[model samples]
Target: MKATKRQYAYYTGMFMILVVALYGIFLLTGKSFIWEGDGLAQHYPILEKFYTWLHQGSLTGWSWDLGLGADKLTTFSYYVLGDPFSYLIAFFPKGRLELGYNLLILLRLYASGLAFLFFARQRSFKPASQLVGTLAYTFAGYSLYVSIRHPFFLLPMILFPLLAYGIDHVLSGKSWIPLAIFTGLALISN
Candidate 1:
């Protein structure tokens, strides 16, 4: 029997919910904490400190957390401070940045799956094949670990598959708008 439009959308929603639930199994099992190497030990704290600085009507210009007031710009330089989404880090409380990061990572992983699924649909791949590819890409070892520490870094990855697909369309006589939009997003995200 053929599925109705609502059924298809319901299936998609269920699948996405499953994907997110499975990806965050560590949290469900109590095996996950927001203490990945540099993310926990250093950068997240600096971001929290920076958040406080912003609330005080100033940027993070000094580093009392480090030895005697060093340059904050040097530290901020290593981070993608200008990225619009990166600014969302400040919304998380000083103590809950790790939780915020974990949530962000999970959401990004799901987004990566959706992006890949969209790209595969553009190629007319079978639904099963697209699902397999999406699962492989989302749960790849490198993605799992790196994204845990650096969800911001993974932002560009959500667009990479779409970027390739967009460029492919442009080469194949399709509109260039997708290509331009994807490229612009990737550039701004990085």
Candidate 2:
């Protein structure tokens, strides 16, 4: 189904509204979204170090910070190297990393919804049903759990629907490029 621009806008806006509704309390109270567990201990610190390295213009060298000095790229590749959204950290000011981190979580959730919408459209689902599926997929238990506990995991979740759609296209005898691209992205991201 060819989605109109208006439909795209509607889906995007709805996703934004849902995300804000679900997470607005943090914004309202000026509370950090960093979870008390892995989010605080692992993810935020990695992001901060990444931001620092990015600003320092040296993301490929050894770092004394990683347990008595380790290879920066190899050490962080599993965490942030391949995730495209991680690069956005460079744009956030040093003092506003908490905000950036929270915003990135929200952005990932929003993008996951949109990715699901795209897949649903590819399956020729009705517009209304697409919205429903998108919301359900975005707010699924696993997604919500990982959003805070392990934000990077959301990347794979977001890619899964799109990968499925790519597979469908390939099975329909369409060009295999979409499948290859999404597969490559999934592999690179993780």
Candidate 3:
């Protein structure tokens, strides 16, 4: 039991160290690792539109911001602007949107790492090997690239491992709560 605790502590410490290093490297250089490409540039405008709606004492009415005021249903049907967690961005002040967004990316990346770690451990991989795989999986080229190019798509990727794990456990006679929670999160996240 003690050894497992020690192992988890080590894994957590290593993961956090990597997080700080990566963030520091990009942030201190006046650049961003996760927001560099089309994702932030493209999505921020839409997110701000949602924010504007919230502050206007409206959630989902016709948007006057569109061409001669198209229906707000366009935002819901065509874009991730309807995602529940997207409202989390509105909590940030206008000037701090970048900070909030980058933080969300970082949090998702670390959560992805932890999910991979859980999956590997469940498959009976050794602890050290699990940590290595977790780090590699989280920071792999595909994830980094997609996070910048297609962040809306990346939301599913983050929850996939966890959702599967939760379902597997439920199937194996464990409680169903975890599975239900992850499923809701996956469906509503984006």
Instruction: Output the number of the TM-score-best candidate.
Output: 2
Model 1 agreement with the true structure over 1-190: per-residue lDDT tens digits: 4433443464367556765666557757775435568777765666666666666766656767656767776666556454454566677877776666566666676677777777866776766676777777776777776666766666666888989889989999989999999888777665
lDDT of 3 by residue, 1-190 (tens): 6966776677778877877775577767887544545655667666667667767767666766676887775655445553545667768898887776676666667667777777677777777887788888888887777666655556665688888889788888989998899888776565
Q: lDDT: which candidate is best?
A: 2
Off by over 4 Å in 2: 1-3
Which window of ten consecutive residues has the lowest lDDT sum in model 1?
A: 2-11
Cα RMSD (angstroms) for every candidate in the order listed: 4.0, 1.7, 3.2
Against the hidden reference, what TM-scores do the models get? 0.72, 0.94, 0.76
Pairs that collide, model 1: none
Query: Candidate 2: which pairs clash?
Result: none
Give the C-alpha miss distance for residue 114 in model 1, angstroms: 1.8
Better of 1 and 2 by TM-score: 2
Q: Whole-model lDDT for model 3 versus the true structure?
A: 0.70
The backbone clash count of each candidate, in order, is 0, 0, 0
